[model samples]
Target: MIELQFSPEVANARATGSPLVALESTIITHGMPYPQNVETARAVEAEIRAAGAVPATIAVIDGQILVGLTEDQLEALGQTTDVAKLSRADLAVCVASGGTGATTVAATMIVAHLAGIRVFATGGIGGVHRGWETSLDISADLLELAQTPVTVVAAGAKAILDIPATLEVLETNGVPVIAVGQDDMPAFWSRSSGLRAPLRLDTGAEIARAADTRLALGLPGGQLVANPIPEDAEIPRDVIEPVIAEALSLAQTQGVSGKDVTPFLLDRVFHATEGASLAANIALVLNNARLGAAIAIATTT
Candidate 1:
C-alpha cells in the first residue's frame, strides 16, 4: 500500500465530505522561481477556497505521497532545487528511492484518484509535441487522461505543442475533450486553437453530469475540461505564434528533450514575451481553479 500523508486542512475536508480539487506541484517547482511560485500557488488555493472547494496540492517527499501541503511545505517546495519532475513513468521510482518530487499533470491525476478526489486544475496538459513524427515524443499526460478517472480542468494543451495532433490523439484514445462555453478548443495563452472541440459543455453542472455519467457507464477514462483564458489576459495568437516559433527553434537547437523540454520552452517563451506568457499562464490557472472548484461542488450536488 502506498503511504499517503494528508495535510490537516485536506484531512478535515475529506472527513467532512467537502468538495476537493487536486492540484499538481510541478507548477511550483518547475514552472517558476521560488517566491513567485509559492505566491501563485497560494493564490490558486485561495481561489479554490473562495469558490467553495478545498485545494489539495499533491507531491511526493521521503517516499510518501502528500495529498495536500501546508504553507511551510509549499514554501519549502518552491525554494527546493533539483526536485524530480514526476509523471506516471517515474512516480514510483522516485517514491521508492525516497526522493522529493513535484507531481506533473499525469502524476497528480494518479494520486488524486488514490486520494478519492475527482477534480484537478492545471494551466495546461502536455500533449503531442511538435515534430512528433520524428521524435515520437508524446507526453504521458495524454495517456493518463485516457485511463485516470479524474476530471481535468486545463486551459487546453500547451500552445507550444502540436494542437491538431494532440486533439487527434485524444479523439483516437476516446477521451472527451469538452470546451467550456465555446466550440473552438482553447490554446494556452489564447482563447482559440482554430480547431473545433469534439464536445462542448457550458457550465460546471453540465460537466459534472457528464463525468458522473461516465462513472455510471463504467467508462475507463476521464474528461478534459478546456477552459479558455480570460479575454483581457490572453495574448493573441498572431502576436504569440512567432514567439513560440522562435522558442521552439531555440529548444531544438539546444537539444532539450523529454521532461526538460516543456520548462525550457516555457522559459524561452516567458523571456520572448517579456514575462507576459507567465502572467497569462497564472491567469489561466486561476481561471481553471475556479472552474475546478465549481465542478467539484457540482459533483457532490
Candidate 2:
C-alpha cells in the first residue's frame, strides 16, 4: 500500500464526511517566488474554507503522498528549492526515490481520487504545446483527466498552449470541456480563448450534476470546468494575445523546449506584463477554488 498523509484539517473533514477540494502544489513550489507563492496558496485555501469546504493541497515528500499539508509543511515547501514538478510520468518514481516534489494537475487528480476527493482546483491545466504536431509535446494532464473521475475546475489551458489543439484532444479523448458562464472556453489569464466551448454551464450546481451524471453513465473520464478569470482580474484577450506571442517568440529564440517551455514563457510574460500576469494567475486560482468548493459540496450532498 502507498503511504498517505492527511493534514489535521483534511483528516477531520474526511472523518465527518465534509466536502473537500483538492489543490495542486506546483503553484507553490514552481509557479512563483517564496512568500508570494505560499501567501497565494494560503489565500486560495482560505477561499475554499470560507466557501464551506476543506482544501487538500497534494504533494509528495520523502516517499509519502501528502493529501493535505500542514502550515509548517506549506511554509517549508514554499521555501524549498529543486522541488520536482511531478506528473503521471514521475509521480511514483519520486515517491519511490524518497524525493520531494510538488504535484502538477495530473498528479493532483490521481491523488485526489486516491483520497476519495472528487473535485480539484487549479490555476490552469497543461495541454498541447504550440508545435505539438512535430514535438508531440502534450501534457500528461489531458490523459489524466480522461482517466480520473475527479472534476477539475481551472481557468482553462495555460494561455501559452495551443487552445484549439488542446480542445481537440479533450474532445477526441471524450473529456467534457464545460465553460462556466460563457460560450467561449477560458484562456488562463484571459476570460475568452476565442474558441467555442463544447458545453456551457451556468452554475456550480449544473457542473456538479454533469459530473454526477458522468459517473451514473459509467463514463471513464472526468469533466473540465473552464472557469473564467474574474472580469475585474482579467488582462483581457486583446491585451494578453500580443504579450503571449512575444513570450512564445522569446522561448523559440532561446531554444527553450519540452517541460522547460511553460515556465520560461510564463516568466517572460510575467516580466513583460510588469507582474500583472502573476496577479491575474492568483485571481483565477482563487476563483477556481470557490467553484471547486461549490462542486465538492454539490458532489458530496
Candidate 3:
C-alpha cells in the first residue's frame, strides 16, 4: 500500500485544479545546511505561489510519496541525516523499505508525473561528469529527461559537468534543450556556457506550447528549459571558470567520483567563491520557479 500526503496549500490547489509545479527535495536535504536549506525551500515555493501556481516539493517519507512538505516537514528533512538520495533505480526500494529519501531530479519527475503534474522546477539538471568515459559517471537526470514526459525548468546542467558532452547526450536522446531568453546555454551559476543552445524559446508560453506539441505528436520525453540566472546574480563565466577548475582539481585529488563528485565540487566551489556560488544557486532556482509556474499555468490552458 502507498500513501500520498499533501500540505494544506497543495491540497487546496489539487481540489481547485490549479496549476502546480513539482520541486525536488534534495536541495533541502543535500544541497545546503539546515536552516538555509529550509529557508531556500520555502522561498522557492513562495516564488512559485506568487507567480500564480502551487509548489509540490516531492520526497519519500516512511514509504509515502510526500508531494508537498509543510514548514515543519521541511525543517525536519533539512536537519535529518542519513536520508537516501533517490533516483529511478532506488526509488522503489526506498519506498518498499519505508525509508525517508530526498528525490533527485529524476526521481522527482517520476513522482510528479505519476501525480499528474506536468512541470518541475530545479536548480540544475545533473549530467555527464568530467572525464566520464573512464568512470562512466553520468547522472541519471539525463536519462530521466530522455524518458519522462514532465517538463523540467533548470539553469542547465550543473557547470561541474562536461557541458558539451551533456548537450550531445541530450541531442542523441532527442531531448529538446531550450535556452530561455538567450542564444547560449546557462551554466548553472553562470550566465553562459560559451556553447550555443540547440533551441531557443523566448517566453514560458512558447515552451509550454512546445511541450504540448510533443505530446500531441506522440513524443516520448519532455523539455529541458534552460532559463538563465539573472545578470546581477551570475558569477560570470570568466571569473567562475578558474574556481571550477580548482574545485575539480581538488575532487580528483581527493578521489571523489560518481555520486559524491557533484556535491564535493559544489561545496568546494562554494568555499572558493566565498559563498557566491550558493547565492547564485538560490537566485537561479527562484528564477526557474517563476518560469516553471508560468509554464504550468500555460499547460492548463
Candidate 4:
C-alpha cells in the first residue's frame, strides 16, 4: 500500500466533505529562497482557507507522501537542501526509496487524484521546451493532464516554453485549455501569450461546471484553467520577451540543459530583470490559489 499521511486540518476537511485544493511543494523547496518561500506558502494556504477551501500541499518526506503539511513542516522544507524534484517519472521511485522530495505539477496531480482532491493550484505548468522539435523534451505535465482527473489552475505554461507547440500538444491530447476571464492565453509572468486560448471561462462556477460535465461525459483528462495573472502584477509581454530571449541565449552559452535549464534560466532572468520576475511569480501564484479555492468550493457544492 502507498504510505500517505494527512495533517489534522486536511483530515478534518476530508471527513467533513469540505472543499479541498491541492498545492505542489516545488514552489517552496525549489522555486524560491527560504523565509520568503515559507511565507508565501502560508499565505497561499490562508488564501484557500479564507475562500472556504482546505489547502493540501503535497510532498514526499522519508518514504511517506504527505498530503498536507503543518506550519513547522513547511518552514523546515524551505530550509532543507538538495530535495529531489519529483515528477511523474520518478515520484514512485522517490517514495519507494524513502527519499525527501518536492512534488512538481504532474506528480501533485497524481497524488491529488489518489487523495480525492479534484482541484489544484500552481504557479504554472511545464510544457514543450523551446526548440522541442530537436530535443523532444516535452514535460510530463501535459501527458499527466491528459489522463489525470484533476483540474489545474495556473497562469499557464512557463513563459520560457514554446507556447505555440505547448498549445498544440494540449489540443492533440484532447485537454481543454480554458483561459479564465480572458480571450488570450496567459504567459506565466505576463498576462498575454500572443495567442488565443483554446477556450475561455468567465468564472469559477463555469469552470467547475465544465469539469463536472467532462466527468459526466466520461472524459479521461483534467481541465487546464489558464487563469491570468492580475493586471497590476503582470510584467507585460513586450517588456519580458527580450529578457527571456537573453536568458535563453545565456543558458545555451553556459551549457545549461536538461533539469538544470529551468532554474538556470530563471536565475539569469531574475537577475536580468532586477527581481521583477520573482515578484510577478509570487503574485500569480497567490492569484491562482484564490481562484483554485473558488473552483474547489464550487465543485464540492
Q: How many residue pairs collide in each prediction?
A: 0, 0, 0, 0
lDDT, model 1, position 297: 97
TM-score of decoy 4: 0.99
The estimated TM-scores of all candidates read 0.99, 0.98, 0.98, 0.99
lDDT by residue (27-120, candidate 1, tens digit) is 9999999799999999999999999999999999878899999998999999999999999999999999999999999999999999999999
Q: What is the alpha-carbon lDDT of model 4 when measured against the actual structure?
A: 0.93
Worst 10 residues of 3 by lDDT: 1-10
Candidate 4 C-alpha lDDT tens digits along 1-301: 7857998999999999999999999999888898899999999999999998999999998889999999888888999999999999999999999999999999999999999999999999999999877778899999999999899999999999999999999999999999998899999999999999999989999999999999999999898999999999999999999999999888878878888888888888899999999999999999999999999999943
RMSD of 2: 0.9
Two-way TM-score contest, 2 vs 3, winner = 2
What tens-digit string does per-residue lDDT give for candidate 2 at 67-148?
A: 9899999999999999999999899999999999999999999999989999999999999999788789999999999999
Question: Could you report the Cα RMSD, in angstroms, for every candidate shown?
Answer: 0.8, 0.9, 1.1, 0.9
lDDT of 3 at 8: 89
The numbered model that scores best in lDDT is: 1
Q: After superposition, how far is residue 18 of candidate 2 from its true place, in Å?
A: 0.4
lDDT by residue (tens digit), candidate 3, 28-92? 98899978999999999999989999999999988888999988888889999999999998999
**C-alpha lDDT values of all predictions:** 0.95, 0.93, 0.93, 0.93
